[model samples]
Target: MVSAGVYLVVRIFPIVQASVVTMTVVAAVGAFTALITALVGLVMNDIKKVLAYSTMSQLGYMFLALGVAGYTAGVFHLINHAFFKACLFLGSGSVIMGCHHQQDMRRMGGLAKLMPITFVTFLIASLSLMGIPPFSGFWSKDEILGSAYAWGSEHGGAYWLLFLAGELVAFLTAAYMTRLLILTFAGKYRGNDAPTEDFVEDQAKLQSEQENWEIKKYDRSLGGLKTLYREDEEPEKHEEHRHVPRESPWVVGASLIVLALFGGFFGFVGAVPLGITWWQGFITFGHAHHAEVNWLVMGISTAMALGGVFVAYIIWGAKFAVFMRLYRTRLVQVLQAVLANRYYMDHFYNGIIVRGFMVLAKASRIFDTWVVDLIVNAFGAGTKMFAYAYAWFDLWVVDGLVNLAGYMWLGIKRGIRPLQSGYLQHYMLVLIIAAVLFWVVRYFF
Candidate 1:
């Protein structure tokens, strides 16, 4: 919907002719929708839904670029969003599957210890989504924001407001993703139920079996025995063995390798065109279409994204500091509340849409059962009762007369039964007599 709305606005409203009023309105709508989607996703318990909402909000930033006619920047962001968002969603799915459908982060903790592959994958994706440098998201988001800042310089208050909002949303994005990681991987287990112990026992047993097999193979090789030997003939096995459950190193190593290649190559390619000359065929082609490098802008954008990561580390990373203790003050509590509630946007929507629908539903039910049904039911019942009385009269009086004619015909047939003969000719004559007798009886009656 956000993408469609943006495409519609860009196609219908010519950028050159659109007034500041139109641009501002389009930008606000896009930004607000994005922010709301992100906030809702953050609070959602379902992991997939959270990523879905995050996708919606991320696209809002892209749409904001389109609304401002930053087509290249928008496209760049769109491409980056695809990579990081897919990684995040899939990584979360992997975690959910590993944990046997436990998606509520509140119920999950210390998963990094159990499923390191999923944890590393999730971390890389989350960092990318947070717009960290060397990741795909950084280049694209920086381009979008840089364009916004440029627009802010020309368009007075509205564009500046949008730029500020984008910054705040960026901070929130980092904070919530950090919160997710901390709850899922950093803390001790806080769930109500304990994990099944059987899995641990099974893993231990498997490790022991693998160790015994390895030792047997080593013994066979050292003895210079080409043929297999019975276990009783093998050398004595060790009584104690260490159990180590390590993931295939290639899994984590391979993902990092791919992501590193993509992160380095995509940005360098995008930057190449800025420095190439016309004489340099391929290099010149890149330079012609690339964005002009503004060292100041790049520095500021890189600092913002890095600052977010640094802040996250200080609060929840491996070396978390105790700065949260200072937030115990009343003023700080109020500020935290405001941020947590998302500045009451959810409350405002609940009041307007949810409450309004509830009231409308109550009124509709009353109107349906009382006013509408009362009049219709009363009229229908009265008409039905009148028709039923008329039907009773018709059944007794009109039907009785018809039955009397049937009884007279029956009496005439019975009276002629005695005169009937056994022969065919005699029977035909008896039928004619009976018809004459019936006509006479009807005329006299």
Candidate 2:
């Protein structure tokens, strides 16, 4: 997934090819990333972290190749990287599991004898990644460096600097890879007390076996329940034990063996030095072109790789006491500190970029709470007030008018109600009164 960015940039090569500036930027970034990550890998203590940095460094190399318009070279390295890096990762896992989940190289050594298959497989993969000859990494990486140099020669100035950086990265990659292999599988074992889990598991198994044997040998009539012996006659204390590293199961070893074989010889598919062009033909994009192996570049790269291995062997393998003395120096300590801290890039991100984003997030929350919520609350209050006014008008003015009309009708009904009594005399009286009222009104006018 981390390499996806390089793949994406390569996928859009037409657009990238259109801009010289983009290509230069990609090359510059790749060279810088490759060198910096390799330096970081040099100081890493965890076996897996070393491999992680190695993957990044190798991805940087691929990007450098793509940036220089070496599409075939880039894709070739990508494929070769997959085989070797996967093997290295699997080999690391096998080591970790064999060491009872221990990953620190400082706590591991002399595992080659215990896990012979893993060591051989891991070494082959390491050699391939270091770009040693005959391995797939050597062919793929040599092509990338040659491409960088050729591109730079055509365009001088900072382009040359990029090529130089690529060379230096190759050197550092070998150094760190050799350092990892040595610390992990060379010298005397240093993790005698580190495998606590394995030790505990073995002790438990031993105790269980002892208890089961005792249960079968003794009769239950001699005691009660599962306890055939009295509490005072309990089992003796087990002796202390150290965990031993062992070879991984056949399933895992088989995968590593297969990948190691490819890592060792897969480069023959694109072995430019040997005039092999099958890989280039198969994975070409746009115009397929042949890559000629430059003897000078090949010689210098091989020397750098070997030189790196030699330096690492002296420092970590041959002269441990002398290296320890140098390691304790103030300058060396400071250099180690910088590399180990990844040149403080993590701190800058956390202190500045991350902090700035967090502050922005807090401000957004405040605005949402104060401004947005206030507007919504005010609108709600206004709507509620308008609803109350409408309720009051309906209850008082509108309903009162209707009630007044009803009362008036009721009063008139009451006034005329006595004339409608249920009697024949009452009806006759009402008719006589009506006639008298009519005569009186006519006489008085």
Candidate 3:
């Protein structure tokens, strides 16, 4: 998320500010991120994701600007980028909605004429991203690069790499922006619409168009158009045709047109070469250091940017045979694999980091289960053993003593059985005999 980068930008700098080490770290991270996201943007099929990565790449540039002490330049681009980028994204959304929610570039083509307002506005935003001549993006980008060049020239070590990366990202920005424009709006209609000569028969009737995106010509790679592929292909399952795309409604188109105006001319707020300086004035930098656009850096950066646009046009719009072969090579295949996987961030996060944590969690669960059960089972086993011992004592020692007493009493009763006769005479004779015996004993003593 942009918030994460913003966190880094806001928090980390104040710890060690206006120093070479800070600048080096910030510049390195920003350049690396810019390059990575730019590559990812090149291979993105979904219209919105390409723009999203572009947004991230632009932020990286802002960081780079800050690192080089061109604080005003960064803010300048940020303001210009925010306006144009919004218009681009919203316009893309309109096209996607117009195309029955088809977001892939491969699924879209030849809508420029149909959606004139959206296309023109979107193209303006693309030019801003491309950093083409006389646009606000050009001025802002020129300032950043000029700042980077100034830093490198001022310090001739590996600091030059910052300038190099800045230039490289500039070109890449142009390439991806051009590619998006050409692929989305230049070619023949490739979407779910049936192959028909008339793209739009009646404008008013198209408001009631179908809202489905039918699948067709996906894996075959018609005329070398790159596809978002699913391995399965079921022609019978798909709807035969989709609705034709028309211009966006007035509400969507109006904002895009207005935003396009801002993105187109907002750079005039800060003159590129010290003519007018709104953004440069606002920079919180050393008061003594003033940045003026270096003519040399400006020429080179502008050329590289425009060259990127030319190269993109040659590859996608011109459809040169050489570019197609290059794309089919093993190197490009490997590169696509990398970009498509988003430089393997997801794999590292989901596969390695997440899996590692899950393993730890499962091990802890196993340990907790066994250890707690052992402690609990120890008490249960001890209790059961004591119960068994008590049962044994009750059955043998205590019960035996009681039974033995009972038997002795029973034996004495049996020995005195004849004395307990029912006859009264017998009972009286025994009493008299016992009395005489006792009298005699007492006299003799």
Q: What is the C-alpha lDDT of each candidate?
A: 0.63, 0.86, 0.80
lDDT of 2 by residue, 103-134 (tens): 77876899999899999999999999999998
Per-residue lDDT tens digits for candidate 1, residues 45-128, read: 456766777788887887776656565666666656666666676667666554444456655667778667767767877777
In model 2, where do residues sit more than 4 Å from their true spots?
193-240, 320-326, 351-367, 402-445
* Regions of candidate 1 where Cα sits further than 4 Å from its true position: 1-19, 34-53, 106-116, 179-269, 272-290, 318-322, 328-352, 377-445
Q: How accurate is candidate 3 locally (lDDT)?
A: 0.80
lDDT of 3 by residue, 1-445 (tens): 5636644664555553557898888877888888889989988877899999998898899888878867677778888998899899899999987776667677688989878899999998888887887888989899889888888989888999999998999999999888998888987778764533432332112322221111233533232211222323222123255456788889998899999999888888887474777666665455633757688998999899999899888888898899989987999899888997798998899799999999999998888889988889999999999999999999899999999999999999999998989999999999999999999999998
TM-score for every candidate vs. truth?
0.59, 0.78, 0.74
Candidate 2 C-alpha error for residue 16, in Å: 2.7
Where is model 3 more than 4 Å wrong at Cα? 1-4, 7-16, 193-242, 286-289, 376-445
Total clashing pairs for each candidate: 2, 0, 0
Reference-based lDDT, residue 98, model 3: 77
lDDT of 2 at 116: 98
| Evaluation by TM-score, superior candidate among 1 and 3 | 3
